[model samples]
Target: MTSTQETTRPRDIGGSPGHWRRMRMWATAHAVDDFYQGLVPAAVPYFVLERHFGYVEASGLALAATLGGALPQVPIGLLADRHRLRWMSPLGISLAGIGAGLSGLVPAYPLVFALLLTAGVGIAMFHPPAGRDARRAAGGSATAMSYFAAGGSVGFFVGPALATPALDTLGIGATALFIPPAVLMGLVLLRHHDRTPGATAEKVRRHGTDQPGRFAALTSVEIVRSTISTGVNTFISLYWIRHLGAGSGLGGTALTLELGGGVLGTLLGGRLADRIGMVRTVQLGNAAMLPALWLMLACDDKYAALPLALLVGLISNIPFAVLIKLGQDYLPSRPGTAAGVTLGLAMSAGGLFMPLLGVVAGHYGPRGALTVLATVPVIAILLSTALREPVHEPEPPRATPSTTHDRHR
Candidate 1:
């Protein structure tokens, strides 16, 4: 291949060269930061069982963390884009971990709420800038972004596992045990933040315009996907245990299978996006999810439901990384804004919809809720089909020799 052709070729499916080193550093910190996000839910059962908090109070605590973590994301994204806040990721990760860790020591309910809120803020702060940087290093390859996402997925699973054991043995205060990884990671990320190539080059463009229509369309699709995902996460265990008469171990196993499918989906989605167009892969994923969800819901046996849930999870998450990349692509000028809306805000918003599903479950049972959730992907599919990929304005064609010669003649 000619040197020029090689230079202009898109990055490999693996990633741009040297991306792994930075991907590892950023992704590792992401895992640590996201661990706190995941830990919040695990701690909820502890509050209910040990603190003697009622369901409403427990949910309020969760609400505090959710609001704090998810709400500030857009403003944070704006800040990262506007100010090039290089230290935000390190600071955010540290505070997120520290807040969650210290929550155990705070005896009062109000104090615990405050601590969780602080941790949520930290988690929120880390994501926008971290994702923006990861994109820069990704060099247009969605596969690289998948690695970043997979790190968080691993951390999410690890958080619950780690929390369950420690909180079981040491009580809720055992949350403090999780602090070291965050602090160490924060320091490491902070010290090396600027070492990567062209750290400032990806800054938000002052005069660059965004495709607002495309961005809006993309966000709508994400909301549907996120709502379905939240529903599955919230009720899949219950469906297994109560509905299918599965034992607690099997219920947990079902949840694990689903989440594990998501991790695998995140990695493979990026590869699929690289091979097929991002839009097509995303559509295919949502299309596959419709049947998977139905199959999971239809399965009468516990074992049958288990693999189906895994399939549902895999199909549901197949667009995860691609959607993030597409959001940024659609709003290239406001990448942080795109990332925050798509990755952070939309997800939290989906949690808000979970109540509606609960209401359905209350009236018609979990099967009814699953039925509604299955239909959510159809909205995603429609949106994906209607939306057009963002098209960069082409540069005026360079003058050809014939044209130049004609002009001279």
Candidate 2:
């Protein structure tokens, strides 16, 4: 399959607009499924404490969810490349819903971790398919994938907020857990009925522009730097609660501030890209983290931690939107693989680094961890320097009749 064919303006199944609209619906459905998988960490501690698991065991459950959810992106990307997105996306959503519902019902600690792992696998399955389908519908621009990624963030916020209240009041059997995925799957199937066909091989693009070779190393750099910054932000929230004696309300406020910053970043970063280019925007986003991290690290007062957490959240999330957009341009033909690797594999790296982070916290405390995380933006700044700006072909100018006559004369 030609690479150009792979990117040919996305046409509807019937060669119309309705197909793109319908596909967006499925993209959203699958994104929410991914969101819940991301949310398990925020809710699992309560589950563990309420269920009588020790702190270590509870942390284990949380860790399992990320590991399972994150590690399978490469295989899933290949599968999505090889197959149809419609069925794969819905099936993944259904599995994630089932996993969330079942996690609450299981009796053993190991069983709970297993449910979380299954939930992660479901998340891994959904993203590549949803992303690829969205690209197909949205006309293969960075804007398309950015919008697609935003849905996952919405899910991430909703999952924790929705689950916390339910589990707090109703001991994990809350039917709401099952409702999200089931409703989404049913909705997608109803909307996209009888339209899903097995994916045919796309003609590979003959142009050298389609393949990203050394760019993989650059993507790896992005993965590590983003993951490290995120891990530090997670640590900051806990640090505030512990060291500053901040209540849950204050910690939640800090988290909210971070999320709000992400919304702002997503909205504005694209314009920044158009004006200054992808490289400058990425550098600015990462550089913004330095002062934000410094503020959090210097604050020893109780009142200061909330704003510090807010700062960390703000700086950490903006770059998130930027990096995902950059990932696709780095590998335009395999945006799905890029999503899986940058968002998937690198997240596991973030998870893998936690043990060392924990030691940093244990020996030097959370403030030291923040300091370490502060270095990530510096690293990202360096990594982004190596990226070549993606070449975008400009539209041709219209020819004037007067010019034609002059040339003929």
Question: Candidate 1 lDDT, tens digit per residue, 294-323?
Answer: 888888999967888788778888998888
lDDT of 2 at 239: 69
**Stretches of model 2 off by over 4 angstroms after superposition:** 1-27, 179-183, 186-190, 193-211, 299-308, 392-409
The parts of candidate 1 lying over 4 Å away from their true place are 1-11, 14-19, 197-200, 203-209, 392-409
Q: What lDDT does model 2 reach?
A: 0.63
Query: Global lDDT for candidate 1?
Result: 0.81
Question: Which digits, one per residue and each the tens of the lDDT, describe model 2 over residues 151-188?
Answer: 66667656676677777788766623664665567467
Give the TM-score comparing model 2 with the true structure, all chains together.
0.81
Superposition-based RMSD of candidate 2 using all C-alpha atoms, in angstroms: 8.0
The 10 consecutive residues of candidate 2 with the worst lDDT sum are: 199-208
Write down the TM-score of every candidate: 0.91, 0.81
